[model samples]
Target: MSKQKTQPSMIGRMLRHLAGTHAVARRAFPSATLKAIQAGIGEGEKQHRAQVRMIVETSLSLGAVWRGESSRQRAHELFSRYRIWDTEENCGVLVYVNLADHKVEIVADRGVSRVVTRQQWQDVCRAMTAGYAHGAYHESTLQALEQLHVLLAGAMPRDSGDTAGANELSDKPLIL
Candidate 1:
């Protein structure tokens, strides 16, 4: 018979950790901003799908595959830092939380470090530490995530909802 591995129980500890994370995320963002972020994510996805359709149309009109490929390359280069994906890669940090382990980690990319400054990170960390102590870290993390989403949404195209129809030609290829 094969032996089954059992997980350890830390229900009380997990609750305490979750409470702390919540507090920290909340402190990082405003309530209105959080709603906006959730809405933006939905809108952005719609826009991205339209942009893909635009590319398909543009490819056919431009003739040769090479031309289409070059255009795509140029488009990517032009908006590399102007979209959410680029923002995440270039100027964002990952906040990790482990309720079971009662641990929190924030990893920032080089771009984020360059733009946010050391003092800012320190301040955020200090606030998070306080939240952890008070069992509000979970909330704090949620707030921070909401704020980050809004910041990232700044990179989305202004008319992101306009989908590219089969017969329509994009004025500017919907760059970023």
Candidate 2:
């Protein structure tokens, strides 16, 4: 009687080595993509370095700078529709309504829960839900766009031979 012993085949050893090497390769990080992602985050931080007050005022002052009453009203209306409602205790709910696009986005600080009453958020959310529920987003956005156009028309400078036009180049009136 003879006892036979079977060792791992040469091909099996080679395949095992190849599998281990491939696993290491997959775990290796791509340095270029990582650098690009880091650079993008740094740029974003640089852009938002300004204080919160500065950002809020800048958004609010657009109306005054445009120098048009209707546009100003529209701006105010838009603000009234949505603003950073109460940031009590370093927390706030920011609301923005892009009526022209029939979209509403809200970002709230969960860290400061109960900062704003749930009722208010619900109301805005309900309106958005209604639009989505009815598939009326497009129609609402169109209406808002029309309103925005009307406001801009009032603000845009006219070429009606007025002092604002290019025809008024003379510093003094010439009696020619």
Candidate 3:
């Protein structure tokens, strides 16, 4: 699992340890912003069969810290916990953001992976994190959702007969 900044300095780590708490995430991406993100997900899914989930976490748990958990590792755990890999078409994707580290991790299901390469996902993650570097959280997230929509629409267009496409997963962005 590759990280954005592989070797953060001791002081940077210490500051991030304090700055990236859950409380901070809530403040950064509050209930209203989260709702907007959920809406964006819903809008994006209308044109395709792909399932998209956005998850933002304020910081790592003490246990995770002791376990040496990285953002990429936590994204995998969240992927399973939220069942992002369990969609009907295996086209679910999770856009995970670790607020403290200002890191973004994009995990796609096997079906989506067939069309979208890991390098593409990494590019999107980097783009999203770049926005965060400028404190443009909402703009970055919305843009990422848009990117997912375009990619998924091209990869997995909606079935014509499926009028009332079901939402296999909640559109609500998980704030951890």
Candidate 3 versus truth, CA RMSD in Å, comes to 3.7
lDDT tens readout by residue for model 1, 67-150: 323333433433343242234234334333333233334444455445455555445445554666666544654444444434
Candidate 2 residue 102 Cα shift, in angstroms, is: 14
**Per-candidate TM-score against the hidden true structure:** 0.32, 0.21, 0.88
Q: Model 3, range 29-89, lDDT digits (tens) per residue? A: 8777888899999988998998898888887865676567888999999999989999888
Better of 1 and 2 by lDDT: 1
lDDT-based ranking: 3, 1, 2
lDDT of 2 by residue, 1-176 (tens): 12222233333333433343322322221334224323432332222211011001112122332342232253334433433233333232233332222234444444333343455444544565465446553343233323322322343323355333221111110110
Worst 10 residues of 2 by lDDT: 49-58
Worst 10-residue lDDT window, candidate 3: 1-10
List candidate 1 segments past 4 Å from native. Answer: 1-89, 98-103, 146-176
lDDT of 3: 0.83
